[model samples]
Target chain A: MNDPIKDFVEQHREDFDHLEAPQFNLAGFKASLAQEPMVKKHRILNIKPASWMAAAAVLLVCTIGLWFFNSTQQTKKTEQHLALNKQNKHPKIAEKPLVKAVTQNAKQTQFAAHETTSHVKKHQSKEEVPFIPSPDQMLYTKLNDSASSSTRLAAVLAIKKSELISYDMLDRLAATIQHDGNSNVRLAALSVLEKYRQDAHVTNLLVNALNHQNDPMLQLSLVNLLGKMQNVKIDERLYALVNDPSTLEAVKDEVYQILLKENKF
Target chain B: MKLQLILLFALFTTGLSASAQKQYKLAKNNGKLNLNISGVTVEGYDGNEIIFSLPKNEDEEVDERAKGLKAFNSSGFKDNSGLGFDVTVRGDDINVNPVSVANQPKLSIKLPRNVRVSFANNSNMYQDTVTLKNLKTEIDVAVTGNDIVLTNNVGPMNIKTLHGSVDASFPADLKGPISIISVNGHVDIALPASVKANLEVISNYGKIYAADDLKIAINPASNPKTNATGQPVKTLTIGKGVQALTIKSLAANSENQDENAPVFGYEGGNYAESLNGKINGGGVDFILKSNHNNIYIREKK
Candidate 1:
């Protein structure tokens, strides 16, 4: 039953094969592929615009911080130089370690290269040493000339912080204690006086202040200072304060305490 | 010698019982009054002239015959200064330095308001009360006998008492520094709600208290380590203003004091364990110091 159909199909197969078997356009396909450009694949690790902006901002902040730090250092150096100049002006003081340290920290070699040579040249016509004035000297000057209590207080604080104070400065502090209207300033002056307690001149000034000061706080402070001295001639003042009816009760009590400690009661 | 003693006794008796009354007007532009009295109650009010009454006893006197008082105006150079004018009452100038009147007739003085006044009482003037009401100027007071109460006064104040208490109420904001120091006495300060200043308070042997609404920074020093005496020091800033208020409790020994060496450090210390703090972020330096006394700073209700 399949012989005639099979023979006919086998005869048509060759005829179909002979007909154009769906010709493929290989050249056109290649040309189309060539027309579309290839796109590169995106990578995972890429720098973004925000990253650049952030980097720039950080750089700006660091640069500003460096500038501020340098400026502060420079200011400190200038202050040190001024102090050195003041110390140098006083021929009595031969050594100023603070001046040495500051100058060294500022790279004195560079400073000399940039400044001392030129300074010598410019000031050679005159006898000027071209010294920098110190902040403490300025403060001391203010303390002497300024009548304001707040100014006096600030100056005293600055002087207290100064590395070296002259005997003149000590005398000024004693004067402030005796004359300043503000008790706070007087109290600070007392502290400054405590530093020079061993000095006989300071002791004399304190005694003078005791006689003139009506402020009980000052009186008490003076009494305490006098009491701390050993083998000193403060008994007369103590006895006077104890006997004086005008003496504040607190002061009398303190004086009594001192007397009792000294076994003079 | 016996005859001289009898004469002295007679003079003393006359001094004790002298009774009189007087009045005086203030000089032009002379608004400042200073009172230095013993056993006298000085009251201030709004008036044009000052009146004085010296009662025979400390108690209130109803009988006019039991009192002696006088008032007068005098002008002269004081301690080589330019001509300074003051009203004098009962041999005590309210304008000059205080003079002691022992065994004398008790005095009552009334002063006009808005006058710059300074009152100072000695230890003999026990329980003397100086009350200044409704004033507009600086008030400086120092009392050794008892208590002083300043109500409704404004401007700068410098007050100190040896063995007495200080009770001050400021109705308005103070324009300048206010310093108060007391030894063996309590201090109570009442500030208006609108008060703004930097405050420093220290108490060597007492407790410090502040109102709840009042912002205070206790021991607000940038450095917490105290000086020698280890007494607590405090700062108070009230309302972020330029003025300061400082209170301190002094101790017999506060702040480390080197006996034989120069001090080269930040050398501030309190005498007592002070109640230190800040109020309103700090301003002008107002300082209060006390020894063996409690300090109370509060906002007036």
Candidate 2:
């Protein structure tokens, strides 16, 4: 080798080396391009003379290896992305809507709102009315609103007009009490319901507030409702609470009066 | 609105002023006091008659001012005209002048062709017994403050009194829905053996003695019904028969009447004796109701 070639090889030696170890096709590459294109006897060739061919051949092999490696890496990434999508995405996403029968079946077995929640676009129900005083507002109106007074007054007047009660209105009143109204309005509602204990959910609501609600006055109204209902279901449920001692005298007299009316006196 | 109220006040005031006239009456025929009032009705074969039962030794008196039958002394006929009527120059003091109206007194009158008695002048507080028999057409009789006795053939009878016992002899055949009432008196009725007609009787006080054949029924109360004071009411209808006999008695039961009998609808029916009202116990298809009274049902054979 010439001195210039030797110097060039020594200086740029690492660039020509592979990280794992210099890899190359010495026989196939060097031998082919070693002799002239016409010389048959001279099989081996000098690398210095075939530097361009050697470099070109190496570059071509690297290009092919890089293409295969990158193609394989892309395939593996695709498989991983698919696996993650399968594992992480919710199962419902693949579902086509229940053709027609499922839609038809949704109409029945309506469950109450705020009850038995499971993720389903269940029936959209009329808002749960509170069991309150008004026939329309089953739930009590929130006293927090400025209009609650007027609404509550309207409810009272409507209640006074007749004895028949609408349970839905009571529910609304209950809801209003739970969410909107002041304790006082709710207490008033309870007083109005004093005569009716057979009402469905309202009594339960009143019973629930027996201890927890802040309003102390509501207890009396609740007791009044419980007693007047005359149902053993209610009266017996609540142990006898003596409210008006003076009434005991009247009750004794009442027994006499009742006996007299019965002609037993 | 104020003006309207003022007008209503004036209208009521005028009505009150108009009702201020206290009623007064005079006799018109020959009776115990010679009063020819239509209250004395005849049933069969007898004409119109005016009668008055006088107290023993209380000479039958005559009020000369009575519209008719004056001349107690002037007539050759002794003051004792020997007529069915009696008269005394000096008679008992009568608060009212009893007289029968010249014309019909807007009353139901049944007069037979044989007997005829018109309005005459007389004085009397009560006529114990009065009969106009053989009445076929019509008759009108009125009496006040007196115990009246009426007997006649099947004709309409309207008897009224202030306070006295009423013994009305009605021909069993006398039909036309009999109605007997007393403001304060006992009503004794004799129904004919065979008769079917509605009867309505009322007495402010006193017992109801009726013929023994009337039936009783109880009325059912209507739903959402109200008593007198807007309270829910339970009503009763008691009695039955061809006649819708409605008997309303505003009578405070004497000791014997309610002694042991459980009385319904009468607790509130007893009227104050001062009220001097009536208890009704006879009628057909009639409604008998009294604020205070005792009602008895009787049947006629």
Best by the DockQ measure: 1
Tens digit of lDDT per residue, candidate 2, span A20-105? 75578788787779765747534454436678888999999999999999868755543322101111123442231232223323
Tell me the docking grade of candidate 1: incorrect
TM-score of candidate 2's chain B against its reference?
Answer: 0.42
lDDT of each: 0.59, 0.37
Q: How many residue pairs clash in each candidate?
A: 54, 128
Give the TM-score of chain A in candidate 2. 0.31
Over A164-196, each residue of candidate 1 has an lDDT whose tens digit, in order, gives 555556777888887776665676678666655
DockQ values, each candidate: 0.02, 0.00
**Candidate 2 chain B lowest-lDDT run of ten:** B270-279
Cα shift from native, residue A72, model 1 (Å): 29
